[model samples]
Target: MSNDVKRPSGRHHGDLRRVLEEAALELVAEGGPKACTLAEVSRRAGVSVAAPYKHFADRDSLLAALVQKGYAEQRDRYVAAMKRKVEPAEQLAAFARAYVEFAAEQRPMFELTFAAGLDKTKYPELLNAGAELFEVLREPARNLRNTEAGSRDLVLAVAAAAHGLAVFVLEGVLLNVSQAKDLAASSARAIV
Candidate 1:
């Protein structure tokens, strides 16, 4: 055999891990969760088939990593989007809007992270990460609830409405972001 093997150079081990994760994410985006195999991700990342194993134990591990990463990213977006000098009500509205925008923009990741049927116990890190995003909402929700018992009901009610609206919008049932934003705002007002 000819000795012409080209090795990956110039990147650290962490970089390789990132590349593997990114490749897996892309595969999931293109072909759903079933298509994201370790061999496929290695080939897509231009590394040897064994390279992925060095970073991920198996396909399931890689998927778990992807789910965890998705949760972290979603949480970061919420934190960044809500860090402004706006009213808590406005922040809540923006939070709902951000959730829909994120789901629409990252459909594959969203599906993998939130879609039913995954075993959360097997991936507690992802579960906690995902819970943290909702936990961030709890503070604002509690504040709104404090306005009145009715206000509390309103807060939960609006959140449920906003979540349903987001799912509808992401699935193409709703067509307009501005309209959704307006509707979410109105729903929030009715809650508080």
Candidate 2:
């Protein structure tokens, strides 16, 4: 019943870090957050149980690293997705679509990245990275800011909507990915 996937050989420091992340991601995907343990990840990663501590101070530290990595990846994708010069409305739509796509593709990491109960104050770097990801939406959101002074609220609303839409689509509420994309696009247009 192990969900461990095979990894390629010739790993370096970066590769080992990625291996740990991948193992944790697989565990989260199979079970929930509780499934991701230092020992379990070490076992799946083919490392000594004590090995993870060398990379991660503890379970929270590992989770923090995963969250930061996930946010960084998502941020990169969002930036790349916005490279085209489209209508503001279409740009926002594309951004929303991209958000859901990232969520769908990286569900386990996404969940860990956004999960509550983590002390953002204790993890300033992760908090800053996560904030920077959200900042990518500010361009499309700026169009809506003039009419509404609540820019922060608008950004949070759009993000929450995208996250909820992704959860719904992943949970089988939306039967089709295309349909989900359309819904997200339309929702972004309406909300932003």
Candidate 3:
């Protein structure tokens, strides 16, 4: 044997976990959560069968990571959308639009995040993600509370309506993103 040792061929420094995450997401998008097996993800990512275990313990953990990413993306979208509007009502409407847009853009991952079988209690990271997402709306909600007209429960009602409308849009009942965004925004404005 030569004195020099050969490094692992395909094991790059920091991208394996990301590659696995992307593979799992693609699998989920293609066939839902059941299709996102560690084995399949590793195979798709061109890594060994044991690769995903190094990043995530099992399928649920991997799925939870995806959910966390989804929430983070949602928060970012809401922040950006709301930042462009000056009035409190416009900000609320923008938040509603971003929520619907996130669902429209990442329908599969969004659905997976809200999947009933995913027992969110097992993942504290998901709780933090949810908190961060909601925190993005806090200032806007509070501002709206002091503005023209809104009930104490108006924020809660608007969130519920947005979620319901997003679900309807994903299920094809809402037909188009334009209509869904309009419905969500109008429902939120009407609530507040």
**Which candidate number has the best TM-score?**
2
Worst 10 residues of 3 by lDDT: 146-155
**Model 2 worst lDDT window (10 residues):** 5-14
Please list the residue runs of candidate 1 whose C-alpha ends up more than 4 Å from where it truly belongs after superposition: 1-14, 147-159, 175-182
Task: State each model's CA lDDT, in order.
Answer: 0.73, 0.78, 0.80
On the 0 to 100 scale, the lDDT of residue 83 in model 3 is 93
As a whole number from 0 to 100, the lDDT of residue 15 in candidate 2 is: 73
Cα lDDT tens digits, model 3, 47-86, are 8898788888888888888888888788888889989999
Residue-level lDDT of model 2, residues 136-187, one tens digit each, is 7776777667744466677777778777888897788886777777788789
Worst 10 residues of 1 by lDDT: 5-14
TM-score, prediction 3: 0.84
lDDT of 1 at 181: 64
Residues 74-100 of candidate 1 have per-residue lDDT tens digits of 888877777762567766776776677
Candidate 3 ranges with C-alpha deviation above 4 Å: 1-13, 146-152
lDDT of 1 at 117: 43
The residue pairs in collision within model 1 are none
